[model samples]
Target: MDTSFLDSLSDSDFDLDLHLIMGKKSSQKKFATMLDSDDTDSMSSSTSSMRLDNMTENGLSEVQVGKDDLLDQCLDALYEKRGSTREKALASIIESFNSSLQNEFVETKFATLLQQCLNSIKKGSAKEVALASHAIGLLAVTVGPGEKAQEILEESLSPISDALRIRPETSKILSLLQCLAVITFVGGEDPEQTEKSMHIMWQVARPKLGANVAAFKPSPAVIAMMVSSWSFLLTTVNGWALNPKSWQESILYFSTLLDKDDRALRIAAGEALALIFEIGNLDKFCGENKDSSEPTIDEGKDSRKLMYLHGLRTKILGQVRGLSAEAGGKGSAKKDLNSQRNTFRDILDFLEDGYTPETSMKIGGDPLNTSSWTQLIQLNFLKHFLGGGFVKHMQENQFLHDVFGFTPKKKLLSGTEQRMSGSEKRMYKSPNSALSKARTQLLNKQRTLAQGRNAGHFAVDE
Candidate 1:
C-alpha cells in the first residue's frame, strides 16, 4: 500500500540498469558503442566522485553512483550483517539473477551469500528460514555452467545433506528438497549431468521413502515434488537414464503406490510412471538387453521391470473390478465403497484416457520409440503403467497381492497436518490482515454483549 519505495527509484534508470546488467548493446548512434574508451573514462571519473562516508557495510544510503559502482554497493548491502539490510540485498540480487550474465556476476560472491543463508537455517527465526529457503531455491535454478554449478553443489552439499539426515521440520525439508530438484536439473539439456543429479537425489530421497523416522513420511505435497522432479529428469534426459538398475527400483516402488489411499500420491506416482513411459524409452528396455551374452530378456534385469509393469497393469483391473463389485452391494458399506470407487476412478481416468503424447508439444531429439511407449501408456494405461508388450502373454496371469498388499483406508483428513495455507496473503499490504480481522470481529462481539448487559440494567432502573 505504500508508494514510498517508488520515491527512491525516482533518480534510478531502471531500464538502463537492466540493459547494462544484461550486457545488451544498443545499436542507436547515441550509445551505439556501449562503454567505449571515452565512456569508460567518464564512468571511472563519475564512480570516483561517489563518497562512501554515509555508506555502511550493513546498509546503503541512496546516492548518485556510476553504473559500475552500483554493483559494488549492491553487494555490500547484500552481505550486510544486519538481517533486514541483507534481505533487501537478497531481493535485489534475486531479481538480477533473471539475466544469466548478471547471474554470473552475482556468483562472484555466491559462496558467501549461500553460506550466510545456509547458516541461517540452523538458528534463524521462522521468517529467516522462509527467506533463506526462497533465496537458495532461486540460486539453485540459476547459477552457471558446469563449473559454477559444481561449486554450488560442493558447498551446498554439507548443509543440505545434514538437513536431510537430521529430518528437520516439514517446511525446512521441503525447501531443501526443492533446492535439490532445481540444482540437479540446472541445465536440462545435458543428459549426463541430469542423470548424475537424478542419481544423487534418489540416493538422498530414497532413504526417506519408507524411512523409520516420523519426519520422513512423504506428505502429499512432498510426494508431488519428489515424483515430479523424477518425471522432469526422465523427460529432460530421455530414456538413457533407464539403463541404470535404479530405474527398476524407482518404477517398482511407484507401481506399488498405484493403490495408495492418498489420491494425490497415487496420481503423482502414476503420472510419474506415465512420464517414464513417455520419455524413459520403455521399448528398448522391455524384455530386451543389448548384450547377448546374458540369457533371455525376461530372466535379465529387465525381468523385474517387466514384472512390475505387469503387476501394475493387473492391479488396475482388480481395482476397477473391486470397485464395481463393492458398489453393487447394499447399505452404508456400499456408500463408502462407492466413495472409494470415485477416488479410484479419478486415479484411473488419466490412464484410461488422458495419456496423449500426440497432443503434447514435441521436443526435438526424441526417438520415434518414445512416442510408441507414450501411446501405449495412454491406450493401455492399465495394460502397462510404464510400458508393456514385453511379455504380452503374461497379462493378468500373476496375482498382485505381494506387490500391492492391503493398506488400511485412511480418512480424507487422517494424515493431514494442522497448518493453514497462504491463500489469504495478498500482494500489497492490507489495512488489516486476516488475523487482525478475526481479532477485530471478536472484540466487536464482546463490546455488543457488554452493551446489551448495560442496556438491560438501565431498563431495570427505569
Candidate 2:
C-alpha cells in the first residue's frame, strides 16, 4: 500500500460512497490520471516553499528544510507522477538530511518538527493524531543513533514532560514519548543513552507520582495513552533486564502507572510486572530473591521489603480479574475493544492460565458478560490463552455446561440430508435404516405415554 497517497487525502475524502458510484475500474483510472498530472508537482513545490518560509520566519535557521515539507513533496510526487519523479523526490528528501546536516540541525529543527508533530497529535482528531505519530516515528528512524541523537532525544523529552504538567491530558504526550522511547531503545545499546532516558522517566514520575499526590480523573484518551506508552516501555525493559541499573527507575515508573484507576492502565501494568518476573527482575521486586553473589539481607528486619512482591502480585491478579470482567461485560467501550481483549489474553498467557470452561462459566455469570464475552471471543488470545488441557478440564466440569448454556454443535455431514454418491448411499443404507426405525419407535412410545396420561386424567374427572 502506498501510504503517500493516503497522506494527501483526509479520511472523509477517501469516500467509499464515491468509489461505489464510480466502480472500481473507473475509480482506478481517475486516480491514475490525478497522479499523472503536473498539478501535483506545482502543489509540492508550493507547499515546500511555504513551509521553508515559515521555518525562517520562526527563527528556525538550523532546519533549512523540514521533514514535513519533504514528506509532503514525496507524497505529492508519489500521487502525481511515477518512476523517475517519485525516485527523485524521495532521493532529494533523503539527501537533504545527510550526516552533517543531520547532526547540525537534528537537535534544533528536527526536534522542533517532532515537537510540532506531537503538538498536532494532541490537537487533532484520532486519524490526524495517528498520522502525526507515524511522522514522529519516521523522524526518529531518519535521525538515527549516536551521542548527538541521544542528546537531542533527552532535550526533546523536556517539552513532553512540561506538556504533561501543563495539559494534564497526557494521551498525545504519552504517545510521542512511547515513540521516542522505542526509537532510543531499539536504535542502540549505549548505556549512557539508556541512563539518560531512564533519568528523564525518573524525573517525570518522582516528585508528582508519590502517595501524597491527589488523585485526578483522567480522560479515556489519557488512559489509552498511558496504557500504550507503558506497554512499549515494559517490552523494552524486559529486553534490558540483565542490566540491574536500568530496573530501578523503570520499575518505579510502571509501579506508578499500576496505581491508576483505569482498568487498561492496570492491565498494562500487570503484563509488564509479569514480564519483569519472567525476565529475572524478581530480585528487583523481592530483595530476598537476589543472587547468591549479592550480600545477604535479614529478611525479618524489613516489613516494607515484602510490599513490593505483594504489590506486584496483587496488581497482576487484579488486572487479570478486571480484564476478565471487562471482557465479560455488556457495555464495554467499543474503541480498541479487541486490542484490550488481546492485552488481557496476553496477560493470561504470561500467567500460563487458560480460558477454561470453568473460567468461561464465571465470566458468563457477570451481568456485562454478553458485551464483554462477544468482544473477547473475537481476540486470538481467547482461543489459546487457556491451553487445550485447561479447556478439557472445563469440559469435564459439570457446572461449566450450565454456565455457558450449551457447547457449540459441530456442522452436520452434508450427505446426511442430501442424496449421497452411490458408494456412500449403499455403505450407509443399513445403518441409516436402523436409525430411522429406532427414531420412529421412540416417537410412538412418547405419543402413547402422553395419550395414556391424558386418558387417566379425563377418566378421573368424569
Candidate 3:
C-alpha cells in the first residue's frame, strides 16, 4: 500500500490493483469517473483525477499508498506515453489479478469485465475495444472451469447478443465472443455448458453465414475467418452434438463451408466435418458398448457404412470432385494441392485404423450413414490427387494384403563381392549396384600394382 509507488503506476496497473483489492464495482466506477472528468486543460489534471479516483475507491488509507506510490513511479518510468502506459499497466494488472483473485472474485469481477468490454465495443475507440477484448480473453482463461463460470457465462450471452446486433463488424467484439465460446466449450469440458455455448454461436453464426453467402461472393478473408471460427467452436462438438438443435446447426454450417468458393474455407469445413464425425462415433461407441476401451475396426467400419448408406459420402465426394477440377486449372494449384492433401490426410488418418467394409454394413452399425464416412471419401479423393496412385497403392500394398493375407519375402543382394571391387564401384544393372562394382574393380587394379612394386623392391634388396 505504498502511496508513492501507486502514484507513479500506469492507469492499467492502477485499475488492476483497484479491481483486485476493491473489486469490479469500485474499479469500474473509478474508470468511468476518470474518463468523465473534463480536466482536458492539463495532463497533470487528468493523471491526478485518475489517481484520486483510485485512492478513494481502493481505501488504501496512508501507509499502503506510500509503498504503492513508489512502485507506481517505477512502473511509470517504463512508459513515456499515456496510451502505452495504460496498455502496459492494464496488462500488468491483469497478470497480478490473475494470480491473486479468488474464485468468487473471478466469477463476479471477470464477468463484469467481459460485459463491460462488450458494452465498450458499442462506443469506445477501436484501440480501447481491442484492449477490452484482450482483457476479456485473459479473464476467460483465468476463470477456470466450473458451474460458477458457466453461470457467469450464461448471464454474459445477452450482452454479446446485443453487441452482435449493434456492431456485427467489430472484430474485437467478435474475438471476445469467440473467446467466450472457446472457454465455455473447450476449457470447461462441461457438456451442458458446451451445448449452451453452441446455442449462442449458432444464433450469431447462422445469420453471418447467410449474409456472407448472399454477397455476390464473399471476401476470402471474411470467408476464411468465419470458417476458422466455426471450426474452432466445432472442436468442442463433444458436448454440442448431444443437443439435437446444435447438431443440426453444426451440420448446416459445415454444409455451407463445403459450398464455399474458397479452397481454404472448404478445407476447414472438411476438417470440422471430420471432427464432428469422430466425436459422434466416439460417443456412440463408448456409450453403447462400454466393454471396449478403445475404438475398434468394427466401430469405424460401421460408421463408414452408415455414412455411405445415408448418402453423406456422395455429397462430400461431389464437393471434392468440384474442388479437384478447379484446383487442376488454377495457377495456385500447388497451394490448393497441399491444402487438399492435408484435409484428406486428416480424414484418412482418422478412419484408416477403424475402417472395414463388413463392419460398416452391420445393423445400426453402418459407418457410411454417418458424416464421418462422407468426409473420409472426400478427403480420399484429395489424397488420390496429392499422392498420385494413392488409392491403387493402398489397394496393392495394404488393402489387398489385408484381404488376401499375403506377406512378401525380403530379398538379399546378389553378387555382393563383385559389386564392391575397388574404390570406385563398376557399373552394373542398378545404379547403386553399378557404382559398387566400379569401386571393387578400382580397388583390385590398385592392389595388383602395389603387389608388383613390392616384388621389385624385394628383388632389388636381394
Residue 239 lDDT in model 1? 58
Query: Which residue pairs clash in candidate 2?
Result: 35-80, 327-372, 328-368, 328-369, 329-368, 329-372, 330-368, 354-386, 355-386
Better of 2 and 3 by TM-score: 3
Task: Order the candidates by TM-score, highest first.
Answer: 1, 3, 2
lDDT (Cα, 0-100) at 208 in candidate 1: 42
lDDT of 3: 0.42
Off by over 4 Å in 2: 1-134, 146-151, 168-172, 186-192, 195-220, 237-263, 285-315, 318-322, 325-327, 334-342, 353-462
Best by lDDT: 1
lDDT of each: 0.43, 0.41, 0.42
Between prediction 1 and prediction 3, the one with superior TM-score is 1
- Candidate 1 segments exceeding 4 Å error: 1-92, 95-130, 140-146, 187-196, 203-205, 208-215, 261-264, 281-308, 316-462
lDDT score at residue 461, model 3, on the 0-100 scale: 16
TM-scores for the candidates: 0.47, 0.41, 0.45
